[model samples]
Target: MFGDLMGMMGKLKETQAKVEETKKRLDTVLIDEKSNDGLLKITLTANREIKSIEVDDSLLEDKEQLEDYLILTLNKAIEKATNVHESEIAAVAKDGMPNIPGMDMFK
Candidate 1:
């Protein structure tokens, strides 16, 4: 019936609004990653914005050590950002299509 179709459409619109809200909230989530040695660290948001970088003073004495730690820390941060981004995207997709199973229909 037409009425039933309209009702489903309204529900879909509500779900879409929820998905948008989730995406907006994700912009506030921050994820941090650091090296095991604690000599280097990076901070990022779910949106993959580089918020900060930290390096230990002792490592400054050795350029190579500093460079290695920086690279490691940067990689870690990127990994963390990627994870957070995936989770946020998943949440939005789930909200948009809770009734559909095994459907990869969103970005």
Candidate 2:
């Protein structure tokens, strides 16, 4: 029983290490999205941290258009980032857990 407990603790530690590594990798993962024929571009990390935004000079004169494009582009970037983040977390979870029927549904 003691040996089994120690083995489980070792596995838990390994999983924790993998989770930390995944988090660091997520910080470096970038998702870029554009809107309005590429008039607006936004870059975000897999963690949904906004990294940069690029807007065409032509939209500078139109605040409403700029706002609309910015909103659309930002949403797209966030959505993409969210999908990537979820997939990465799911990968980690699947790696740490035992294989079971319908296990993926939890993710």
Candidate 3:
């Protein structure tokens, strides 16, 4: 029983290390999204940090329209980043975790 406990502990430690590594990698992931018929573009990291935004000069004439497009584009970029982050975390969990009952919850 003690040996089994030690083995499980070791596996948990290994899994923790993998999760940390995946988090670090996620920081470097970049996702791009566009909206308003491609008039607006946003780039963000998988960690949800906005890197850059591009907008067509034609939208500058209408402040209200520009604001709406900005909000929509930002939301789309954030959604994409979130999906990528979740998938990466799931992959790390699937690869590093042991086949214990209830472990599928992580996936």
Candidate 4:
């Protein structure tokens, strides 16, 4: 029983190490998704917070169209950011063992 407990503790430590590494790597990754016409662009961190935005000078003249495109571009960038962040996190999560019963806590 003691040996098994020691092994589980070791696995927990390994899992903690992996989680820290993932967090560090995620902080440095930048995902930039833009619109087709270059009218709008969004920059996001790996955690999917909007870091910056850019709008073209031409779009400033058209109120209605610019409003529509702004919404579209913002939505698209957000969607892409979510997908990219999820995939990156999933890659890390999948490599580690599932947090289920009878399974290794870290792989």
- CA lDDT, every model vs. true structure: 0.76, 0.85, 0.88, 0.74
lDDT of 4 by residue, 1-107 (tens): 78777776777677667877876776677778778977788887776778888889888899998888868877887787678767766666656543557665334
Best by lDDT: 3
RMSD of each: 3.7, 2.7, 1.7, 3.4
Please, what are the lDDT tens digits per residue for candidate 3 over residues 4-100?
Answer: 7788889889988998998898889999899959999889999899999999999999999999999888988898899999898888877777767
Q: Ranking by TM-score, best first?
A: 3, 2, 4, 1
Writing each residue's lDDT as its tens digit, candidate 2 over 5-80 gives 6776777688778888998999999998998598888899999999999889999999998988888889888999
Model 2 bad stretches (over 4 Å):
98-107
Candidate 1, residue 87: lDDT: 79
TM-score of 1: 0.67
lDDT of 1 by residue, 1-107 (tens): 68776776787787778767766776788878888977777887877788888888898899998898888888877787778777776766665653434554653
Spell out the clash pairs found in candidate 2.
Answer: none
TM-score of 2: 0.83
lDDT ranking, high to low: 3, 2, 1, 4
| True-structure RMSD for candidate 4 | 3.4
Local distance difference test, candidate 3: 0.88
Count clashing residue pairs per candidate. Answer: 0, 0, 0, 0
